[model samples]
Target chain A: MSWMHTIFALILLPAIATGMFRILRGPTAADRMMTAQLFGTCGVAILLLLSTGMGNPVLLDIALVFALLAALATITFVRRTWHGSNKRNHGNPL
Target chain B: MIYSILTLFDIILILTMLWLAWCLLNTEDIFKAVVLFISFGLLMALAWVRMRAPDVALAEAALGAGLTGPLFLSALRRMNRTRKGERRLDSDENREKEHKANQEQG
Candidate 1:
């Protein structure tokens, strides 16, 4: 069982690295946002795998919290993007 | 033997993850990239399941793949339309001049 955790970490490490590259090097703001979301999700998965490998239930709450936070961050980004474009369309009445 | 079987599944899961990651990186269209990223999230969930982390798998499927992916794609679509509209608003004479300039420069 412990080996399984190690295996997953090894498997996911490269994927996470590639995602980080996208987050850093993405050409557009939207690309960076998507990459950041991917990284957060992968982090949660890693935490869960580690928690289970160690037979500890406490980490489940951490995973949940991380998921909620990631969702909130994505929502904020979406709202900001929408508002920015709306301003552009309306000719910046402000 | 059971342990070996489990390891084999893990290997397969890892391979799938790599493939998804490749797709996410190489897709040209932003919309397609978002879709591939979501698929990558789903594959990650399966990888977690194979590793015996059901809780993580659920979170990955729900929050990672499900909510975030669609949110990003819709946002991208809106951004694309706004950009297109801005370009369309440009006067035709200006557009033609710019096109001619580009041809001359190239």
Candidate 2:
């Protein structure tokens, strides 16, 4: 049973590894962002698997935190790159 | 069989980590580097799991990969803005210098 859980977690790693290739070879910023998004989701899944396999509940909270903050990078990207750059485009009045 | 599988998994995880870290350091673009860095964190979290360290995995997933990706992007933006500001300052100084030269000639 425990080995099953371990194998499950181990199997998911290849997906993340593929995502790393995307990050390495990405031509656009958005591609990289998408890959990071993959990281968040996959990380959560891996954490859940480990948590259950090890019979440690604390890992669940970490997974929850991962889910919550997953979009934080996107938010910052939008605010800093898109919104902040617009200031210069509108002809900075100041 | 299970031990062999576990050993194989550990080998792959270690190789993936080393590959990602190398790519992160060698990548030319700062944005790509940031992305790789996040991936590194996430992979590190996986390694923590294999090593039976849940606490470290949690922190790596949340603070390391999650928050830090955006932080690096913003830092890149801040750098560009400052670079632009410096260029503008240099151009303004050049304009002033040219203006003074014109006045003296006239």
Candidate 2: tens digits of C-alpha lDDT, residues B1-106? 6566678788988988998889889877877787788778878877887787878877887788777777888778878777875333236776798689889999
Worst 10 residues of 2 chain B by lDDT: B85-94
Error of 1 at A51 (Å): 0.9
Q: Please give the fraction of native interface contacts (Cα pairs under 8 Å between A and B) kept by each candidate.
A: 0.00, 0.73
Error of 1 at B56 (Å): 19
> What C-alpha lDDT does candidate 2 achieve relative to the native structure?
0.78
**A19-87: candidate 1 lDDT, tens digit per residue:** 656653567666766776786677677667756555666557756766766665456556655455566
Residue B51 of candidate 1: its Cα lDDT? 63
The per-model lDDT (C-alpha) reads 0.64, 0.78
Clashing pairs in 2: none
Per-residue lDDT tens digits for candidate 2, residues A31-86, read 77888888789878977886766667787888887889888887887677656765
Give candidate 1 regions above 4 Å deviation. A85-94, B1-106
| DockQ score of each predicted structure, in the order shown | 0.05, 0.55
Which residue ranges in model 2 land beyond 4 Å of their true spot? A91-94, B1-3, B86-106
